[model samples]
Target: MNQYPLWKNLLILGVVLFGILFALPNVFSQDPSIEVSAARGHEVTEATPDEVRAVLQNVGVPFKAVEPLAEDKVLVRFPSSGDQLRGQEAIEAHLADRYNSALTLVADLPGWLRAIDAQPMYLGLDLRGGIQVLIDVDMEAALEQGLERYTGDIRSLLRQEKIRYLTVMNDANRVTVKFGDAETLDKGRKLIDREFRELEFETASDGKNFDLYARLAPAEEEQLRDFALQQNITTLRNRVNALGVAEPIVQRQGERRIVVQLPGAQDPARLKEILGATATLEFRLVDTEGSVQDAVEGRVPVSSRLYYDREGRPVLLKRSVIVTGDQITNATSGFDQNSGTPAVFVNLDSRGARRMREVTTENVGKPMAVVFIENRTVTEMVDGEPVKRQVRTEEVISVANIREPFGRRFQTSGLDSSEEAHNLALFLRAGALAAPIQIVEERTIGPSLGQENIDQGVKSVVYGLAAVLIFMGLYYRIFGLVADLVLLTNLVLIVAILSLLQATLTLPGIAGIVLTMGMAVDANVLIFERIREELRNGSSPQASINAGYGKALSTIVDANITTLIAAVILFSFGTGPVKGFAVTLSVGIFTSMFTAILGSRAVVNLIYGGRRLSKLAI
Candidate 1:
């Protein structure tokens, strides 16, 4: 029985410790890989897998493969190369393709992992030197978008019904449609209610005059706001993920704010260029017959101006905007056979198609333009190049008069190259942010800072372990050495389990391990002290050892139970790094209890078995 327990304890400890040591290489080893993290104005967040793929695709970089980690992160590895940037560019382009956003280049691991390489644990931004971006999604912007949508729907409905109105304007966040009679107003209100279930209306009548105000209900407003926030977070995640940044933290902070953390971002300027821009595409109708001539001749239409040279770019005349970018569902890059150059293929929804048909039919054989806006401003081409536009209809979908639903997949052909088309597709897919977001807070940690944290964390663990070992050995003597052996064994088992789980080690987690190391000796101390007490009462050595373990068992269970309860509470309430610490601590406590109680008992039994002891050391 003694041989069995001793062998069992040794076998368990050896298997766990050896398992961790063996698996370490696979988890942390750098196999010609690229990792990305973002930095914006001193804020850093790790890039998601999608973000990393985007960067790689955008830059035409090649990767062997890409693997995803939980929490919007990725692992990217490239073939060994002399040009690291080239590999990075490939990864960046992949990220952009997948996420449609730029990537912030993170750390490039050494060709191999050495003995001193960081433990396979989550390195928090505070310890890893990264970026933190706190974005406040603009509520006003989301409201404006919703309002615009409502207005567009109203106009289309009126046009379809052929109801003429004198003034149709959206002012003060309310769509004011003045019809010739109250009957028309009543009809319009009912039509709106039928289409938009989320809309709320208040009607006012003064004699024959009438006005209707349409708005969102309180519950609907809250829902809309939440949707807007989620969209913002999603978009941000997409963009950051595209950048090939590693381990980015993108999360909704409050009602209308998001927090992004990039663990390794080198270029802040590039991050700003990618994150701050709002890419929007619109199709405006052209009044080809009389636009430039009449406007220059002082015949400007109401609410429309003839810009001879608008935004200091071109001399193009347009009458009224037919459709906003919101109607566009998808855009892709393709080629026009006639010109043999690059082009973008664009797709619209049913409403957009109908509007396109009407506008194109009305202005056949005329010049039209597709306006691309970034951040509410039109993006101007540096060179004045001829850009052709096409308007598609139902005929394009169901050719030969066959009835077919329009395919969701549409192309935006006629771009210069695959890159341009890809970029456009990315932009369209990203769509308009449900709201505008402003960075309210940002913090950037440097690589040096991360290194410093590592240094301090290691120092604490070393000192803490040393102090514990010294105190245990001096107080418990021979039994203390056995306990110390168990304590070291406890660390090995904890790390093995952590590695097996692929858990990230944060600074607090290091403290947790240190605490576990200190407490590992508690059970052994209990048993050894009890044995000494028994020896003073003239008990035999074997009897003393048995008595000591039996007496200590109840105390160990009570103490460990309280510790386990606290660990569970910490884990439940904590987030990110704190949670990691709690997990490691809890795991450590359980392992320590097993090794300390069972392991120490096995060791004492081996020492005292089948032997008559002359004296028992106290």
Candidate 2:
């Protein structure tokens, strides 16, 4: 045999060594994230800078930053301990005693990055520990929203066609409207089919036998249901996002079911409250001479409303509504010229605009109230008391295109800061969850659990690798030793690449690495067996060595390609665990091919390339 060549082997070894040097630091470097939780039934409202600063300062936690997320919602970063429980307790105590706000302890995590340490990957609730909730939306409420639209449309339709209606009642399943007489009713029915294309009219057998009912099409009924469900989900997502939970999983489960998974979530009940509370808005006329002082002095009338302007100054308005929350598209904070103080700008829908114009045109000088609930201006409190529901416009009412829930930008002014206004926006948007949701499962993983998972995963990998090394050494002799060396290098390269890519390594991912160890040995087995077969054919050592790799290439490619295809499909279709497994499996195949084929090839060529096979025992 020829002398063993060192230079070629050195070149390959140098490349592996270079990869190791480049990859280790990134793999080992870690970032840390903090976790916090909220109590059940508490909703976060906007807090002023001073209010937030005071809470953090009083908590005795060394906070680096205090960010206002929304109303009562905040992100506080502490320099020490990162213990969310401690920070929460302190804030809870402060708010309970000093601010007197109804606050709850919800879960919290670190803002984004901890430069000093590696934080654990923020796992989904299914992967890590947290709460899973499935909510069933009430079909009744959805139907009601649809019914309201129908009632208004039918009333307008009748008035336009000069048809007099004696009764209009919606019975959930169908809408029944009665005309004054048979002749008028027949004309009304024909007009409804001609003008209101969405309705299907038919005569029903009843006491008067004069009812014309319209049944919605199956597709239209389904569309209405979908619209309701979507609006509910959208509102819920907005509410959760405003709370500052990163990656809160909110998706529709079925036709009317919603699935919400709050990873690392502490108080699931608070979610129920925030989601369930329907903050509806309304506009009403304010009575004149109705002031906060009038209410305090017991001189305020039930026909009037007392409201504070953006400057906290009180004003009076009539008690009737010109428009309601349904007509509002959105609201935001702005400035008013009268008192030069901050005020809320209201945006109304087209229907709201028409109503406002009609009311304003009728009552040119009367005052009106703009009330907010859960953050949205819901209804005006008339003269410090609730008034009978009615739609009446006031002269002082300001009409604008800025509608609540408007597609375009609408604003409410009079906020202390831009932060307060933003919170208001989120509150309006969250509206309410379509229905109630209860947490079915929840668990907070302490650092101990995370550390335990890490320890166990490492132990498994170490044991598996040990087994691989022993088996390879016993089976392939010298070739086995070379395989072991390449296998070790392969593991290092895989980790280095994972670290560089910042790919998350779950428990399953570690399993992939162990499986990679076994597959890496297969490459050597194929090459060694090919060499043995060649040598048996009476081929020289150099010829056998060259033929082994050449012959093994086809088999190697076929096996790896099949495995790779499976991995790709798994990665594409699988959700959480399967995806993690696919990633590791895919990475393992690449590393195994490299170390087994290229690494072992280089080492083998070094040994037999220079005709130094005197001690070889193939």
Best by lDDT: 1
Candidate 2 error regions (>4 Å): 1-138, 149-184, 187-257, 262-456, 496-508, 602-611, 615-618
What's each prediction's TM-score? Answer: 0.58, 0.58
Worst 10 residues of 1 by lDDT: 393-402
Total clashes, candidate 1?
A: 73
Per residue, candidate 2 scores C-alpha lDDT tens digits across 467-504 of 88888888878888898899999988787666544455
User: What are the C-alpha RMSDs, in order, of all predicted structures?
Assistant: 11.0, 9.9
Error of 2 at 376 (Å): 13
Superposed on all Cα atoms, model 2 deviates from the true structure by an RMSD in Å of 9.9
User: CA lDDT of 546 in candidate 1?
Assistant: 80
Q: lDDT of candidate 2?
A: 0.59
